[model samples]
Target: MLGTAGKGVGGAVVWFTGLSGAGKSTLAEALLPRLKAAGKKVELLDGDIVRTHLSKGLGYSREDRDLNVARIAFVSHLLARNGVFVLVAAISPFREARDRARATIGDFVEVHVAPPLDECIKRDVKGLYERALAGQIPQFTGVNDPYEEPLAAEVTLDTSALTVAQATSRILIKLRELGYLEESELARAEAPGNAASAP
Candidate 1:
């Protein structure tokens, strides 16, 4: 169990890591408002948005990727320690950075959003996969680049098989199971109009 007594209140980092089109942002966006409604101070650090700001000018090299993940982890660690539910949606392809993040932020819940690579390709609205496959984008994750899946994630959701609502519900259940949320709040969190309005 993670310590919440001395830290003020519920402050845990719910990290969503996976391939680019694996629905990490979708789930994080779905969960954010519900967490706010539940009276938790929450912040979402999206990979694309962060890349434009925090990781500007960083290339696609392994060192750059690791540095990007490190910056996100550092921010997450600060937010989490200060009693904020930080939702990070990043590819974060390396396990080393994630392990360091878990160590840094003691109360960390890693949610690995893993779907089949083919499924991700099919769902690529941005045509990132197509471009990467065509060699237009170098070192893109899951194509020329690598995505190291989590060996033991607290929650692993296969977006290919599960509906958005179902996947979000499973994450909420995990949060409750880990004692980040109250048992009485599960139904409310999982309720249909709360966070997951999309099918």
Candidate 2:
């Protein structure tokens, strides 16, 4: 129940959901190094990365989005079941899809990264907001399309109020609190001979 007990292999699936350019990927990137430093086995399955691999050729239609989320969720569940902690940074616009992922994955934590719409547009890393506004792209997640907010999430980061580092720290703290990192394991990892050991 706490970290990896015996050779059973404990894993966590963290779902970071937010609008594009809302710092979901940014926070996940920041969190990765911290977790690695702490000797945690971690992997990030970002939306853009998944799109290139698992969700190729998927369009912006609602049905396509559903399929995309489903594919990502399946792969994520497989990874988690094998004892690799996974971080997913995707818009994942529908609550139904997210719930399906949770149902499939045994240990899942949903983290909502909520940034103001204006701020997301201003930060538009891919220029998607501009294209959506200009009618160049339709059915964008937060533009013409819908984003169903999670009714219950393990954690919610207000990116508008927190720096990326702060957000990452908050997530790590939550993971520790949730027994993703057992106290005994963390203590052992910090021991002199074990400090350099990898998870």
Candidate 3:
């Protein structure tokens, strides 16, 4: 279990939940280099990548989805226990499943990448929304299935309204508030010209 304080910043799992096109992956991708540049050991367990490896056999049924999430949570727990920050960007539509993950992780930060269903559909990066609506896909979350919004997430990002940089800025603020990022490191990540960082 990852304690509040440890030999280092103590590890954490920052879990991002949202609809398909909710910018969860985009935000996670944007923040990863920032975290790494701050000299932190961080890993991103992206949903699509998880599906390819950890959840290859899992189907779209609620039971299967929960299992998939549980697998990711378990991996995150193990990694976090070893002092590795795990950033998970999964749809993770069920509240119960997400709560279970929170209970299992030592230090968990929940960030909801919120964009309305219509807004998500409008983005449609993979044409998933169009396909799902056309009945090409079954058991799609937020289409025929449900998305249980988080009531107590540490932070909520309106992905539709804010630029990725702005949303990432808010996330850095929250991590600083939770003691994950030192003030100086947070300030550097917050700065605009820091992408010149080598690592």
Q: Note the Cα lDDT for every prediction shown.
A: 0.86, 0.78, 0.85
Error of 3 at 182 (Å): 1.3
Q: Which has the better lDDT: candidate 1, or candidate 2?
A: 1
TM-score of 2: 0.86
Ranking by lDDT: 1, 3, 2
Q: Give the range where candidate 2 is weakest over 10 consecutive residues by summed lDDT.
A: 190-199
Report backbone clashes per prediction. Answer: 0, 0, 0
Task: Specify the highest-lDDT model's number.
Answer: 1
Prediction 3 global C-alpha lDDT: 0.85
Q: Model 2 over residues 23-63: C-alpha lDDT tens digits?
A: 88887776666666666788999999898988889997888
User: Which lDDT tens digits does candidate 3 get at residues 69-131?
Assistant: 999999998888777888999999999999999888858899999987899998887898788
How well does each candidate superpose onto the true structure, as a TM-score? 0.92, 0.86, 0.92
Q: For residues 100-170, could you state the per-residue lDDT of candidate 1 as single tens digits?
A: 77877778899999999999999999898999999999998989988888999999999999887788888
Cα TM-score of candidate 1: 0.92
